[model samples]
Target: MGIFDFLKTKKVNDETFNSSQFQNEILAFALWKFNETNDYYKVEKELWGIQDFDLSEKQIKIIIEKLKVFNEKKN
Candidate 1:
């Protein structure tokens, strides 16, 4: 088997991945990516994408607020 073939294999079923227990993994990714970018406009624009995402509006707001804080803390 090719090295990349392992990535094609399902590490976890969809149901488990959607569970709250697996949720922090998703949040951590967004936070990490958000911090990686330097522009505030880019961050705000990217934040809007979560409006149509599967997560609730409250969750989206929380992430945006958290990201805003990330910039604030750096100054």
Candidate 2:
């Protein structure tokens, strides 16, 4: 391996870290919205507006389902 290869690896790692961080931010916002409104459709629309990444329908449903379970346990 060359010395420059480490730079490429670091870039990939940074991108992965940023992506996960963004996901966490999205989930946090979604959870807060869900807790407040208990309306997944509104949360989905809000998330779609704020995100830079392409969030699929399945992913949105999964997040909403998880949030519902979480809210149920908290109550």
Q: Against the true structure, what is each candidate's TM-score?
A: 0.38, 0.58
lDDT of 2 by residue, 9-64 (tens): 22123354347675577578889887787788888887666534556566666667
lDDT of every predicted structure (CA atoms)? 0.56, 0.66
- Single out the weakest 10-residue window by summed lDDT for candidate 1: 48-57
Regions more than 4 Å wrong, model 1: 1-53
Name the candidate that leads on TM-score. Answer: 2
Clashing pairs in model 1, backbone N/Cα/C closer than 3 A: none
In model 1, the Cα lDDT at residue 45 comes to 58
Measured by lDDT, the strongest candidate is: 2
Candidate 1: residue 52 Cα off by (Å): 11
lDDT by residue (tens digit), candidate 1, 1-75:
887965553444457545776556554655666768865456555645543244444555555675667657878
Q: Residue 15 in candidate 1 has what lDDT?
A: 72
